[model samples]
Target: METPTRTPTAPPAFADVLVVGAGPAGSACAQLLARQGLRTVLVDQHDFPREKVCGDGLIPDSHAAFRRLGVYDEVAASAQPVQHVRCVGARGGHVDVPGTMSVLPRRQLDHILVRAAQQAGAELHTPLRFEAPLVEGERVVGARLQGPEGQPPVEVRASWVVLATGAVPQALTAAGLCDRRTPTGTAVRAYVRHAELAREITQLQVIWHGRLRGGYGWVFPGPDGVFNIGTGVIGSHSLEGGKGRRRGRNLREMFEDFCEVYPPAARLMREGEVLGPLKGAPLRCSLRGVSGEHWGRPGLLVAGDAAGTTYAFSGEGIGKAMESGMLAAEALLHARTQTPAQADAQVLQAYAAALRQLQPQFVLYERAGIVNDWPWLADLLIWRARKSPRILRRMAGVLDETQNPARLFTLSGVTKLLFE
Candidate 1:
C-alpha cells in the first residue's frame, strides 16, 4: 500500500459522507454508506496493515456482524477459529467456557476491512492526520486534514461527517461535541510466538492472577503460533496511596508477575519472543452518554467509540462499533431525502434509537454492573465454577452471551454461590 502523499494543490473533490478513521468502525460505516450509492471517503492517520493494540479476539456476536456486513468469509479466511474460552482465577483454579469465537491479528483484520470498504466504492485516504472539524453555522460541515509530507492541508466537505475515531474521543470533545472524562482502566499487551503451548492449548484463555485488585490477565491465541498476553486493572484501584503516576504498578509488571506463578505460561515465555512493543491503551468505563442532542448537529454524526458504544465489562468495542457504524450509514441515507435541519434530526434520532433497540440487553447489563462494579463477585463465580464441571458449562453459556445472567445465575449449581 502506498503512503498518502500531500500534493501542493488540494484535491478538488467532495463526498456525501466523510468518515474519520479507517479502523473497523469507520471502514464498516464507509462500506455500508458507499454500497448504498452514497459518496463516502474514509480517512485514517496510519497506513494499511498498521498494528493496533488489541486482544485481537472476535466474539460470536462479532462473527454475526461480519456476516451481516457480508465480510464473514473474508474474516474467516484470515482468522483462526477459537471454539472455547478458559478462565483461570487467582487461586490457580480455572473454568473452561466453551463457545464459538475467532482470533485474528489486528494488522491483517484491519487491512481486510479497509480493502473491503474500498471495494465497496468508498474512497480511502491513509496517513492523513485529522486537523479539526469544519463548522458551518451550528453544524459540522466537514473536516481539515494534512498529509504526512507537510503540504497544504486539504479540506473535505460533506453532507455528513461521521466520527469513528476509536478510544480517544478527543477529536469530538475538541469540537465541543462531547465532554472528555478520565479513563477508568488501563491495559498493556504484547504478542508472543510460542510453539509449545501453541500446540497444547488451542483454545483461548483469560487468566486472572496477581496483586492487581480489579484486573485480570489474558492469553488469546492467534494463527502461526502467535498469542496476545496482557493484564489490566481498574484505574481507580490501580492508584497507590492516592498519589502520582509512579504510585501505580504498570500492567506489564503485573503480567510478568502472573507469568511467574503459572508454570505453563512461564515455560512459554522462556521459549517465546515478543513480536511487538508492550502496547497500552485506556479503557473507558463511562463515556459521556450517547445522546441525540449532540450526536447530530446539522451535517455531523458520531458513531462507534466516538459515540461511546463500548461495553463496560469486557471492553468489547468492535462489535458495538460495527453495529453503530452500519446504523449511522442507514441514518445518513435516510437524512439525504430530507431538508438539512430536519434530515440531521431524523438521522441522529434514527441512529440513537437503533442502537438502544438493538442492544437493550446491554443497557440492562450495564445497569446491573455485571462487569465493572462487581469484580469480587465475578472472581468468586469463576472460582466456584472451576471446581464443578456442570457449573462451568453454565458459566460458559453466560460468557458466550447466549444465556442471560439472571437465568444463568439461577442454575442450582451457581445458586450455591449465594449460600456460600
Candidate 2:
C-alpha cells in the first residue's frame, strides 16, 4: 500500500456525518455510512500505510467481520494463516486449542480498510488532527480540526459525530462526554526473525506463568521470517491480590525477563534476530463509565477503543472494534430516516440496546481476567483440559468466544474439571 494522497484542496465546511480517526473502527463506520449515501467524512492525523502498534493477529471472528465488509480477500492476500493456539501453564501443562486466525500487520490492514471506505464514497482527509467535538448544550453536533501548521483550522459541522480515536481517546475526552481519567492497560511487542520458528510456527502460542499470571506473553507468526512477540498487563492486575501475586518485575521488565526465563518463548527468541525496538501502547478495556460510554448525549456515539470495546483477558479487540463500528452505522442509518427531533433519542436507544447485549460477555471476560491472576487454577485447568476433550473444547470455546464466558465459572463446570 502506498501513502494516501494528502489533499491540498480547501476543506469542506460540512458533512452529513463526521468520523474521527481512520483506523479499523472509524474506517468501517464511514464505509457503511457512506455506502448508504450519507455524505460521510473520515479524518485521521496520520497518512495511510503507517505503522500501528498491535499484535497483528486477527482471530476467526475478525475474519468473519472482514468478510462482512467485503475485504477478507484483500486481507487474505497479505495475511498468514494461523491454524491453532497453544497455551503453556507455569506448572508445565500445555494445551493446544485448534482454530484459525490471520496475521496481517496493521500498516497493511488499516490501509486496505481506509481504501474500502473511500471506494464506498466516504471523503478521506489525512493529516487532519482532531481538536475537539462541536458541542451545543451537551450535544455533540460535529468536530473541530487542525490541519498542517500555517493553515487555518477548520470546523466541519454535521448532524452527528462518531469518535473512533482508539485508546488515547482524544475525541471522546475533548467532547467531555465521558470520564476525565480513562482507565487503561499496557502492552509491549517486538519483532523477531527466527528462520526455523518462522517455518515451523503455524499456530499462535501464549505462555502463562505464576509470576505474571495476570497477563500472558505471545508469539504469533508475521510476514516472512518475523514473529510478533508481546506481553500485556492491565493496570488493575497489580491491585489484585492472589496466590499468583509474588511481587516481581514491571510489564517492560517482565517482557525482558520473559524473553530470558520463559523456556518455550526464550528458547525461540534466543535463536532469533531482533528486528525493531520494542513498541508499547495503553489499552482501553471498554470499562463502562471509566473508559467512556458507548451511547453518549444526543447526536454523539463512541465506537471502538474510544468506547472500550477491547476484551479484558486476551486484549483481542480488532473484531469487537469493527463490530461496534458496524453496529453504530446501522443505528445511525436508521436514525437518519427519522424526524430530526426524534433521531438522536432513537439512535441512542438502539445503540444502547445493542451495547447492552454485549455487556454480559464483557463482564464475563473481566471475571476471566481476574481468574487468570491465579496461575495455580490455570495450571489445574490446563492439565485437566489436556486429559478431557470435553474440557478442552470448552476451554477453546472461551478463547474463540463461541461459548459464554460465564460457563467457565459455573459450579457444574468446576465439578466436571476436578472430578470428571
Candidate 3:
C-alpha cells in the first residue's frame, strides 16, 4: 500500500536546517533549533499519533528532556507514572525494586513532541519518504523527498542537515556518510489492553524468563490499562538449534511459551486483545567510529540512532537520542557565522568531543554484565535479592541510573559477590 500524504503551504526557499525523521531525536533537534530562531523543517514517513514498536519504558533521564522541550506536563498527562519495577528471574524467582520510571505509548509521546516543535516554529511534514540527499561536492546540502501518491518530488535545500533516522540509518547509508552494520538481533513487540491484568501487576515489571539464548521477555505497563509484552533474541543464537529444524524461531512463538509460564501474563493472553500485528526490527548497540569525522561530512550531521547511541544492554535509545539531537543543534547554531568548511570541521568537532565525553558512561553500562554478558548474574542477583533487600535496592539504583557504576561495585553486598 502507498503511504498517506499531507501537504502544508510551501515555502519559497529551503529551511536553515532540515531534519529527517520525526521521532524523539528529530523533533527534539527541530524544536531547539527553531526556538533559537533558525528556520527548521521536520519531516517523517508516518504521520504523528502513529504507533511505533517499543518497550514503552522511560528512564528518569527522559523526564529531563521532556522538561527542556516544555512537554513534560503534556507527557505526564498522557503517560502512567511507574514508581516501582519488579524484575523476575529464571526459575520463577522475582525481586520487586522501587524507583522512579514511566511508560507511555509512542503514539502519544511522538505526537506531543512533534506538536511542540511545530508550535516552536518548525515546519512539519508527514508521510514524506526521504529519497536521497542532495550532494554538492562532498557536502550534503539537503534531501530529496517524495510524497504519497503521484505527487511531484520536492527538494529541500538546507545549510545543515540533521539525520535522526532510527536504527535503519537509511539517510546516512544512502548519502555514503557511513557504513551500515547489521544489528546483533531483532526485538519483537506487541501491545495488549488488559484492565484486569493491570490490577494484578500494577507495578512496571520487566520479566526475563525462558531458555531462549541471548533473548528475554518483558512486560511494561503503560497508561490506561495498556501493556507492551515482547521478546528479543540475538539472531545468531536463534539460528543455533530448534525442533522442526527451522532456520530460526520467531518472537511470537517464544512469547507464547513465556506467557504459558507466568500466571498473570497467561490471564492477560486469555482475555486481552492485541492492539495490532506483532512488529519486529533489528537492534544495534553501538557503531564503530561514531565521531564527527565519521558522522559529520560537510553540511550533514547524524544524531540519535543514526549516530549509534542506543545502549547495548537495555536497548534504551530515547534519552540518548534526545541528548545527541540537542548537541547537534547547539553545534549548528554555534557555526552559523563560520564558512561551511569551518562549520563542518570545527563546530561539528566540538559536538563530537562533547559526545565522546558523555558516551563513556553509557557505553560502560552496556558492557556491564547486567544487560548483555551474564544471564546467570541477573538470575543469581534476583534470587539473592529475595533474601537480601539491601542488595536488591542497590542494584535497582544502578538500573535506575541514579548511581554510578563505581558506587555500584563498591557496595559491600555487590563486592561480596565479586570476590566470592
Clashing pairs for model 1 are none
Candidate 1 per-residue lDDT, tens place, 1-420, comes to 334322223323688889998888898999999998988888888878788887788987778779987889989987888888876656666666888789998788888888888889888887676778898788888889887785778898888888877767566665566554445566788888987778887777766554544566678889888888877654442345657453355677887876887666676677898886788876554333333454556677777767766555465667777877888888888778899878978887887688667465565334433333333455677766666676666666666566555533324324565565
Winner by TM-score between candidate 3 and candidate 2: 2
Ranked by lDDT, the better of candidates 2 and 3 is 2
Q: Which lDDT tens digits does candidate 3 get at residues 1-420?
A: 213234384432598999988889899999999998999999988776688777878877788888888999988988888887787766677778877678998888888888889899899887777888999888888999877787888899999888887777566667676564555456888888998777777676666654544566778888878888887764322223555342355777777877887666777767898888878876555543243354677788888777877666566678778888888888888889897778888766877787777767765654552432345556666766777766767767776576554433323335465544
Measured by lDDT, the strongest candidate is 2
10 residues in a row with least lDDT, candidate 1: 2-11
Q: Which residue segments of model 2 deviate by more than 4 Å?
A: 1-10, 236-249, 287-294, 409-416
Question: What's the lDDT for candidate 2?
Answer: 0.79
Q: Against the true structure, candidate 3 has what lDDT?
A: 0.73
Q: For model 3, what is the alpha-carbon lDDT of residue 155?
A: 90
Global lDDT of model 1? 0.72
For each candidate, the alpha-carbon lDDT, in order, equals 0.72, 0.79, 0.73
Which candidate has the highest TM-score of all? 2
Indicate the residue-level lDDT of 364 in model 2. Answer: 83
